[model samples]
Target: MALAAAAFTAGCGGGAPRLASYVSPQFGYTIPHPAAWHRVETDGGRRVWFLPQAPPAAQPPEQTAVDFLVVMTRDDPGPLPEIDVRRLAMSLLPMHGVSGFQRAPRGNEEIAWYRFELTGATGGREWASVGLLVTGPKRLHYVVCAGALERWRTAQKVCDEVLRGFVPGDLSR
Candidate 1:
């Protein structure tokens, strides 16, 4: 299944690039990303980062551009209610300097998930991001897709595609 997922690619016409699926056996989740993106995993698969193929040439050598998608998972004490999940998502906003925050709830009665769209400035650079927080039976999953403000349109497209393809692991396990 991993090999098949790795081999599968979806082409987008009119100059749009193709994408490939990244399946993490350790985490039991899958995310779609551009073929050229660089992937990094840490904390025993608790966190994963995906960066562009290369930093922009105009970027200062000392300051690498902060554009990437990150997925993080942590063990929760137990199941949490929708209100708690929403509060948790709201709490994360300030930490990221997030503004223009908008939230949308997802999932059925068994799972509590919240999605947020926000714009923020960090290190003097403006950026935009889409964040998702989900509460499972025993764990919480968070995914953040962000990019530079100037390139937000293109970034948002990729972010949308990534979100659409994201499949969380079986939290009941």
Candidate 2:
């Protein structure tokens, strides 16, 4: 988590770039991502997917250095649970094979949003990542933004933009 935060801040001193909207008709949600990123549908369009544009001259152009996903969850009764970002971040360590896991210091405190950071092996390589968990009135939303540790610095701004711009839909409709 420390590594991911450092990478996020290192190259993200300037303001975030423009974003493009991604809306889901079934779920009625809308989120923004970097305009340069490409969208690819999967799971028969049940899920939303976006991949960051690799920097010029990157060794493997096809390598998904950074990616984002918006996932919808089942409806539940009662009030939403207060998500402990620190505990939540630590909980992912075992599942992601993360050796060092920590939650970044909180920067924003939205009523429905929680953020986390982690490092783990993916595709035989180490990745530094961040994720946002959001709760809507009728359902839960999860957004994961991750990139290779080496290139995460360059990808952080886009990740932040996407997470911050997320707007969940009106599930009651």
Candidate 3:
């Protein structure tokens, strides 16, 4: 598979890190992430996680300032109702303290896709996430990028970049 290089700057202003594409051979989807981040896969490639490197020692270990992205897919049983789709998306998120739910502008008319943003408290830490659910012909692609609310503005930029670059389905094959 061919991986394209892209430049991404996290936070306000600093040197941009080069990004590399990650193609899921098993699932047939691809996304780009900063080269410095670590990748972890589980559930036989059904779920993938992109985690940033360890934080500086100056940061308190207990300070749950987390930033990461997770991509997951499951078999889709054809198209679903709008309410059902919204329900499915909400079910994937934290059960409590969720708000600011709004559907993102649509793109790609062929497949049923929903993009949204929400904030919620999980594990006593507030987080902001941008999530996408694409009901493809054969699979339901769910991608979410989240970060601590304290740094949400910066994290949202990176999350948007990752979400925009995401392409569902196996394009490499």
Best by TM-score: 3
* C-alpha lDDT score of every prediction, in listed order: 0.64, 0.53, 0.66
Clashing pairs in model 3, backbone N/Cα/C closer than 3 A: 28-169, 28-170
lDDT of 3 at 66: 47
Better of 1 and 2 by TM-score: 1
**Overall local distance difference test of candidate 1:** 0.64
List pairs with backbone clashes in candidate 1.
none
- Of 2 and 3, which scores higher on TM-score? 3
Q: Candidate 3 vs. truth: CA RMSD?
A: 7.4
Candidate 1 vs 3: which has more TM-score: 3
User: How well is each residue in 109-173 modelled by candidate 3, as lDDT tens digits?
Assistant: 44676787867665587777887887755567888887777667756777888889988873122
Q: Name the runs in model 2 displaced over 4 angstroms.
A: 1-18, 53-66, 69-79, 83-111, 171-173
Give the local distance difference test score of model 2: 0.53
Candidate 3: segments with Cα more than 4 A from true spot: 1-16, 54-65, 95-110, 170-173
lDDT of 2 by residue, 1-173 (tens): 35333433333253454577888877777888656565665455654666543323533222333333434333532124554434444453322533333322432232255666656554466666666655545555556666666767766666767667777665333
Q: Roughly what TM-score does model 3 have, to 2 decimal places?
A: 0.75
Residue-level error in angstroms, candidate 1, position 50: 0.5
